[model samples]
Target: MDNAATTKITENVLKAMLPYLRENYGNASAIYSLGQKSRAAIENSRIKIAENLKVKPSEIYFTSSGSESDNWVIKETLNPREKNHIISSKIEHPAILNSLKSVERFGNETSLISVDEEGFVNLDELSEKIKDNTKLISIMFANNEIGTIEPISEISKIAREKNILFHTDAVQAMGNVKFNLKDIDVDMLSISGHKLGAPKGIGILYIKEGVEISPFINGGEQERGMRASTENIASIVGIAKAIEDAYANMDENINYTSDLRDYTIEKLLNIDGIIFNGPIDNRLPGNINITLKDTKPQTMVQYLDMYDICVSSGSACAAGSINPSHVLRAIGRSEEDSLSTLRLSINHNNTKEECDYVVEKISEGMKKFKNR
Candidate 1:
């Protein structure tokens, strides 16, 4: 239900974090015994996360959130030089787009690749945008709003051939997809903890060996002086546990959620004036974004709240804004179509009953809207 924005933390992750919050509270930079213990815990978490991604622990840099990681990668790659050119897609999360806007204020150049009706970027156009001055290519592995997975491997290959740095905001695709750093070979990648069932306020940036970049924050010698400030030991530990749990059960979880997604889509399709956005098959397992013609998404969300069913129209980060979804617009949706879009992301914890209830409530909501 609330899967698009975030997910409820699992009991295991919570349990792992309790001890650090309660007794093991110590600064990781301190040389005391307690500090050493906390530092060891952080290191272990980094190793586990790196193992999952098939990267060395030294390659992972923990930060405040996925947004911070994305911003850092962009600024670092384009800094200390005059020619500032970045390539990204239009369907990226606002974290990347908005940060790029900030970079542009300093005379940086950017090319936003447009997507097709299914929200997949035009790779041929993407190739054409790359120039000798293009410093970096930052794209999302999956659309947070429509759940369309991008051909990142292909994109990364192209960037490699062009000698351009590549970064992917894998926040939405981390737990849901199988990715190995060795295969992707991107220069940088961003991931968040809360998206995979860990707590918020913690994220990871994987910097491939030999990638030169500047730190976003400066203070103490943490994260090998790449990032500063005392580490969030509890959250980092929980993030590792969350990633380990998610990866271990990924296959079963994907199968279960995909079944729920298919069922939900089938029922919603039976309803009048509803259309599914994004690719039918090449999307995340639990994502189902739909446009309900003749009904406003805000009104639908309010009504669904009465049934204790939570959903979203787009990225939660951009919630409460009246603007139409940029991702939807990138996919060629009209303003009305964009305004009517509703995102119902699912997870392994969601039940078949929940999907049926959502469909029933949506149908009833539509009738009310029609009558009005």
Candidate 2:
């Protein structure tokens, strides 16, 4: 049920990518016919993606991953030596937070606007934090852990009024929630293919036509001298097809998952000491993050895995360190409670029966934990 972390690539996406993997294998930068075929595929994918997002194809820049896209925007846009500030929320992905460290190292300022108990950004605080030196504002379109969809239009309006550059990490929101770049008015945006049923290691950075920023990766001409690297043609084709499929079935998928999600929530809440973590409204359709009182999330995860059910914890596991999730903490969860969070993200492929089995196993685990 951990669709938020990644999704299984659909057959349609796989079929579209197969040609690039087999017959169309060639360097997109080369001059041979085979290479030109790859190039043509890339351009067609770009146009299709642009049409889906309601933006020009020229605005799309492919990157290795969403993290790379986020880093490119933060590191390339704000010159460390310049007296400038960038604003983001406390609940953003590590990609944004870690990149901001470079800004602080150079004596420049960064403002982390706080979020409310439901994980929505405090717009008034964001507005108050902006100063004369504030040059960029990057908030996420939707949070990955809690599934809280932020107010994108309002945030863009705030940035527009101040003439500050606005960016959003839409990695989690790309196929799940549809928004038009022309209407949202964001200067830049980032998305990952893996989150939307394409393979990992492919992402997109959408830059408004007139927006100015330095190149991220430096090498021989590629990505129009903006990002330098040979493209992964197969994954690029996969992402394009994945997005097309997602858009076509968006409403049906939304309705199906929304109903299953509400049903699952009702069933799971029957367990004593269970509590919901994220907002009930303005939330993603297929997400259910919750805390099971007095049970460690890691232990619960293992217990469920034994029954062949997969879920994710709210704790961050990096290197050898395991810490409570910054997301749960930002939303007013205590440290111990934060460690008890379990993220259950369902998709269209999941059925109500699977959710019932998951709930039954979880209920059994909670009982076992309580008895112990």
Q: What is the clash count for each candidate, in the order shown?
A: 0, 0
lDDT of 1 by residue, 212-268 (tens): 898878898899998999899999999999999988998999999998899899999
Q: Worst ten-residue run, lDDT, model 2?
A: 314-323
TM-score of 1: 0.98
- Error (Å) of candidate 2 at residue 364 is 0.3
Give the Cα error of residue 50 in candidate 2, in Å.
Answer: 0.3
Clashes of 1: 0
TM-scores of the models, in the given order?
A: 0.98, 0.97
Best by TM-score: 1
Please identify model 1 stretches exceeding 4 Å from their true place: none
Reference-based TM-score, model 2: 0.97
Give the per-residue lDDT digits (tens) of candidate 2, residues 145-198: 889999999999999999999999998888778677988989999999988899
Error of 1 at 180 (Å): 1.3
